[model samples]
Target chain A: MKLLSGEIISNEKCGKGLYKIEVFSPYICRNANAGQFVNVKCSPDGILDPLLRRPFSIYNVEKEYNVFSILYLEKGKGTKFLSDLKKGSNLNFAGPLGSSISIGDRSKNFLLVGGGIGIAPLYFLARTLIQKGKNIFFAAGFKDNNFIEWSGELTRLGINYRIFTEDGSWGDEGLATDFVKENIKKYKNYKIYCCGPRDMLISMQDILAGKKISVTALLEERMACGVGVCRGCAVKIKDGNGSFVYKTVCKDGPAFDLMEVIFD
Target chain B: MIEGSGINLSVNLGRIKLKNPVVTCSGTFSSGLEYSEFYDVSILGAVTTKSFSFVSRAGNPPPRIWETTCGMLNSIGLQNEGIDFFIKNHLPKIKSLGAKIILSIFGDDPGEFKKIAREVKKVESSLLAVELNLSCPNVKEGGIAFSSMPAEVEKITEAVCKILEIPLIVKLSPNSDSIIESAIRAKCGGAEAVSIINSIVGTAIDIDTFKPRLGNVTGGMSGPAIKPIALAKVYFLAKADILPIIGMGGIYDWRDAVEFLVAGASAVGVGTANFVDYEAGKKIIEGIRNYLSKKGINDINKIIGKAIC
Candidate 1:
């Protein structure tokens, strides 16, 4: 991946607390895939407190305009700087850097599960799957109604959607796991795709075990080189000899068979 | 006479031929993959990859790194995809970047080192050299710091040398009390080159919370603060003339790169500075060129060992 000087084409609040930043980086946009991320060099000289680059998944690619949009939560310094960016600010970024989810046989029904910010990537995947004429089933978990901004996007795409919250303020009062267990037969013919906190993915893997479901999960790990050069993103897998083996998330995957990963 | 033209900035480390004396230290900036989209990887003398191990590691939990003045401390936990996966997947990608790939290997035991080295050597076409990480104390066994014990260092390096035909750079740990002895042991163990002063063992505590700043509790300190110590080691080790020294510590600019050269190093490695700016290597290269032009140096070879009295 190459680092490009991206001008902020647009920064708008898409829904709720999330902001959509459309950065115009011709170099990155040309090579950027759906699930990969860019390490944004936030400030010009560098940022204070949080000095390292922030990682963001590529939200969407506007090829004709040579721009790629990143959706992020403005919680820390890196995102804070990113949010306050003027219209023409330039960001030093590297990208098309991680593994994307595998989209196979569009004719089969697909079940997607995403938790909190994890929904960012599933949105991209959802768009891709819909383009291929797949019947999509979605289960999204958020804290409350304030985080349900993505509902409109799903409705627009004509996707079958369900929302779960820890509190009963919106959707169901239980977790996504509850919703899946309650509605397993509905997704029996579909492949399951998941992205979220580690526990959520692990839970999904457990509930779907021994079923006809094929599960692929997107994992998040702290990374140094979005490329495979740094092993910082390695995840443990079960070895053939009933031992443990390691795989890199950046190259080998951000996507892997749910059964292959040995989650802690 | 041109101001900097007379200086020779070229040095040979084992089989790898570098255009200049500056190199990037491992675990910093990483290879072309990090900024491959924005920066030119070929402009640097060479790229040292982050340390890798035999197993895939998630590394230490978040809050893995902290930035200090002019440098940083990281407890990356020796995270890496196992050697098998690296050779199968990453080698071709790294080779495509055109920079000399210095494979950094770390493990818990000498046998693991041999395994990684053997597999890496099997794909010698993609790698220029193998750098054994012996300094990290985070792992339960086989840290690069194994060289702290002269005999063990010799034994480990020897074992690695036996399996690989490519040049071997024994990355020395600064945690040792006597770095010279470690260097000597590495050479005796069949190492063709040595990289001095992997981050010194250091710690950072938050004032408000009064606790360790990194998730790993302690970390290897890198950047300008460790340069003097690194320079001293390079200076003394280069005296042996048995192996080339890849000197690095706190090297943020070309002038700093030149210091390692003047201190008797054939090449230098850039760390910490790589994170501060994406074009750090190119800027340093330009600065070195300007220094050479000012000194009236045409061939970089003359600069090696120029500091000798």
Candidate 2:
């Protein structure tokens, strides 16, 4: 079903240069999955730069009143325009699209690694797994401690959470991949999930190359159509012919098994 | 006060009623259908499907798009699931949308359009219209972009019009020197409507990298920059008899829609604007409504071709 256009019920600056815009999209809030996303059209009048829709991972969805939230860093014109939206402003978007994470196949003991805004989907994944009695360990990487937004929930749920900042002002100094590599031995039988920059995922893949750890990595790439028709978001995959064929990131997955995809 | 603010604007495309005109350009929002759940689909005037072909196309490799100052360049290579798969999986779902569905169909030759259109006509209840993407640059045929010549455009338009009983919208290419001639041929071939212009042929160079921005080396450009050219082509096409005009090119708001209407379009297709604002269509509707009210006009049709006069 098509999601209804949302009104910006509120906008507030949560941290330095980062803002949270709450939209009342009942349809989306109710149907959006943890790993899904929404394509937001930033300029209502079309005078802005980058005249194309921007896709963001579902940060959170409140099904009760049908409210959805996106936490973003005001990086480009699109984000800047979104940040400027006031209460009662209307924003058009479409979503809860893309391949969702199937929690049914995951192990009871789970480890989630996120970097920057990649933490968006991790929050929802951790919450769902925790509800099912999955032992959750979430480690995040950011430029600074100000980027951490899940402290209270992590504490309340009794989920073991760690933070790594690039400047070493947070829990650790290096990338989140190192922590996964160093700690993989301790959680040998656990399922590993990660979302972050390409380098981080690639580095993690190298560390677990010979290990017995199962990994599901979320990738970010350029996509033209959210559906498989565009072929703009094709990622290399094993075809029936035993050769690597192109499958859509939006359809085949934003999340794929480590063995199924080939990284640059 | 801005025009779109405080306006309850929405529209219906086929069966789906969008909250507005602002929508992601086809091939720009590749999160898949799932993303529609988190965002507002009702805010768009319509959701145009990505260009599809007779068979599944792998499209071009990575670096398919590059962001320019006011627009984006893309050479997606017209990747698709083929018409058969689209009907099997996508058709059933599109029928359920609250907004209108515009199918963008691309083919290598005239026969492909007719074949796809025939199949699509079977599920016409799910769609508002079929957009002929005969204009996309040919990936396999040394980039001999279709819709550039009048003969090819006429051939495809006539072929699809023969098979499909529903509205046939031919999307025209801006790369051609004589856009009106192509429009005339399409109209003569029985196009129910004509949409122009589909991205200008362009290329972007990376200064430091010393290479073209797109993987295909060349791409079609869309955004505000192309608005003038699109408007001119649309105006020329509107001069012809029969069928309606769906004008598009960097349309961001109500004023843009008005321009298209004056230039001889019945309805406007908003593409590039979706990237800037998802609610652009809604806002544009509101803006147009207010403009109409202020001008003491009850029906929008009165303004059609007014600019040409």
Candidate 3:
């Protein structure tokens, strides 16, 4: 479906410049999977000033309540408009888009890593794995205490998570990268998923090189026509033939192997 | 034939005909594959494909899109899987959908355009017309857009017309030095119609990092912001009374479409609106019908050049 409307259940500030909006959309709850996204129209009804729809990863989907949540930072005009939307107002979007995650080797435990707003999609992944009777450990890192309240989301969801912030204001004082490095031996065999800042993803790519662990990174880019047509969110992938071809992050993946992605 | 409205919405581009006057811009609607998931694309007058080529193409790198106040800047460097891929994959699907198609093709030069037009000639029976894409701003082919030069426009149009049995429509640019000359030249080259205007050349800068937002540093701007400029261009060519004009640029709804028609456009192209609402085309089609019914105008052709008169 191209345009789906959802009513805002709650839109609240979670931390410094961070927001978590829950929307009531039975269609999305039934259709969307972890790692997919919804492209939202940020402006008010009949307003095309903010002309493009913003793509946000499906942060969490609560099937029981027929609701999905999005965690975003007040980054730009679009996010600002989204943040200002009042509760019970209708939001229009086109979604359940992008590639769904292919959770491989269920027998292996799950290791989820997130940085900043990248934690949004990981929450849904953790929730899905937990429901599937999998053992998952979520390791998240933030710049400061920016995502302080977001940590509460994991706690409320009963996810086993370790928090790391640079300022030590929120959790353990260190980088999530360092934590992953410190705990690599213990979780090397675990199925891993990471989403975060590009710098962090680059670092994760470097750290996980030749570790023989399955890792998927959710990528975000400035995109138009959240479907494959526009070729806006194209990323180079190392095809099996050792050469690279341009693959759209929207269609081929917002989820791809950390090793296969050539992030320039 | 238009349901109960008693309005004759059917229109003629040239030797060919369309059930309605609304079409999708090349590169924006993706030959109607994705949009077909939302509505029956047969409702459209025609579907113009993204720029066709003799060989497949890979578009620009990431950060190809940047949003502005009332529009967007995109540098999607015409990525497509060539004509062979389109014929084997998209053409059959479009045929199945039972919608008229216009093949919009681009080339590095007139010779290359002639080559693609020859291939198009093989499938001309399936297409309503051929659209020559002479003014895409993103690619660095020959260092600038071909439509910028009037002589090149006439030369390319004439070359393609020789091979194509179907009517030819020349797609022009707002960034051209003088689109009037280009349109006149296209008419001289035996083109049956012209689609104006392609995205205007523009740029957006990231304030945080103080760097260019698009990976290509510049892109073509489209949306409601360019509507007035498009209206002026369409009005000009229609007054020139050369060939039929297909006007487009930020047409969002039926009102925008009607504005283009009143300004002397025989048809309108829906571009950026497809990205905003999947049902934009459907709504515009319905809206045009309702508008015609309400105004007591029995024929859509009656509205063309009304503003110019």
Report how far off residue A92 is in candidate 1 (Å). Answer: 1.7
Off by over 4 Å in 3: A105-107, B142-144
Ranking by lDDT: 3, 1, 2
Q: Write the per-residue lDDT of candidate 2 for residues B62-96, one digit (tens) a residue.
A: 67767777777777787767888878887666555
Ranking by DockQ: 3, 2, 1
Residues A1-264 of candidate 3: C-alpha lDDT, one tens digit per residue: 457888999999988788889999999999898999999998886888788888999989988999999988998778999999999998888888988887755555998899988888998888888878889889899878877666777898776888998889888988898988877899877888999988888988888888998888999887888888788888888989987778888888899988999887
lDDT of 2 by residue, A10-93 (tens): 878777777777889877876777778777777654356555667777777767768888877788888888888899989877
Give the proportion of true interface contacts each model preserves, from 0 to 1.
Answer: 0.27, 0.40, 0.85
Output the better candidate (1/2) by DockQ: 2
lDDT for each residue of candidate 3 in B105-126, tens digit (9 for 90 to 100): 8888898898898788778899
Instruction: Give all candidate RMSDs, comma-separated.
Output: 5.0, 6.3, 1.6
Question: How do the residues A1-264 of candidate 1 rate in per-residue lDDT, one tens digit apiece?
Answer: 665677788887755657888888777767766567777776555323344566787877767888888877877666778888877877677677787666767547888898878887787788778778888888989877766664776678788888888877888887887788778887788888888888898888788888857888888775544566545456777776887656767777787888878876
Task: Give all TM-scores, in the order shown.
Answer: 0.79, 0.75, 0.97
Q: List the residue pairs that clash in candidate 3.
A: none
Question: What are the interface RMSDs of all the models?
Answer: 4.4, 4.4, 1.3
lDDT of 1 at B13: 80
lDDT of each: 0.74, 0.71, 0.88
Worst 10 residues of 2 chain B by lDDT: B8-17
Candidates ranked by TM-score, best first? Answer: 3, 1, 2
